[model samples]
Target: MAEFVEVAKTSEIPAGGAKVVEVNGKKIAIFHVDGEFYAIDDTCSHEDASLAAGTVDGTEVMCPLHGARFDLKTGKNLSLPAVFPVQSYALKIENGVIYIQV
Candidate 1:
């Protein structure tokens, strides 16, 4: 069974924006792109930085610390310095509220 926790409302994050939320003591970054929502581990795999603070270009997020890029849809490390993909969480939106499966 999966447990879903409400993280934020749709209005909290605008299109092409992101926010960091803590669920079950784990930090997760939620991104809004083209009216869709995606969630992933907030920490950068290459360094100790917040992915939520990184620059988002389409579905790719560049790590602020090392310029490593990651695919928001698949959590794939799309650049150097970050060989490991960050953990991507399941997300759902219901009635304007965003839920994350932890």
Candidate 2:
């Protein structure tokens, strides 16, 4: 069983914003939407673009390099140029801080 690791504080990510943190050498993207938090692999499935830098609309994130859309909650590829889905990480919040199961 993997233990959850501290990533960032809730205040570090504003609503409709995201930030990337490395865990076990893997980059994980943490998103804040509508007072909720989500975690996913930072790299876009379509390419090497960073999803944390991509634009977010609702629960979806559009890859900045190739314009591919991915679901932030499930890491599902939702549009063209991407046939694969990225990995989604389990997240927990305690005392305004974010932790991820990596």
Among these predictions, the greatest TM-score belongs to: 2
Per-candidate TM-scores read: 0.96, 0.97
- lDDT per residue (tens digit) for residues 1-102 in model 2: 789999999999999999999998999999999999999999887778999999999999999998999998899999989999999989999999899997
CA lDDT, candidate 2, residue 57 = 95
CA-RMSD of model 2:
0.7
Instruction: Estimate the overall C-alpha local distance difference test score of candidate 1.
Output: 0.94
Question: How well does candidate 2 score on lDDT at residue 23?
Answer: 92
Model 2 lDDT, residue 80, Cα: 89
Over 4 Å off, model 2: none
Give the worst 10-residue stretch by lDDT in candidate 1.
17-26
| Colliding residue pairs in candidate 2 | none
* Candidate 1 per-residue C-alpha lDDT over 1-102 given as tens digits, one digit per residue, 9 for 90 to 100: 889999999999999889999988889999999888999999998889999999999999999899999999889999999999999988999999999998
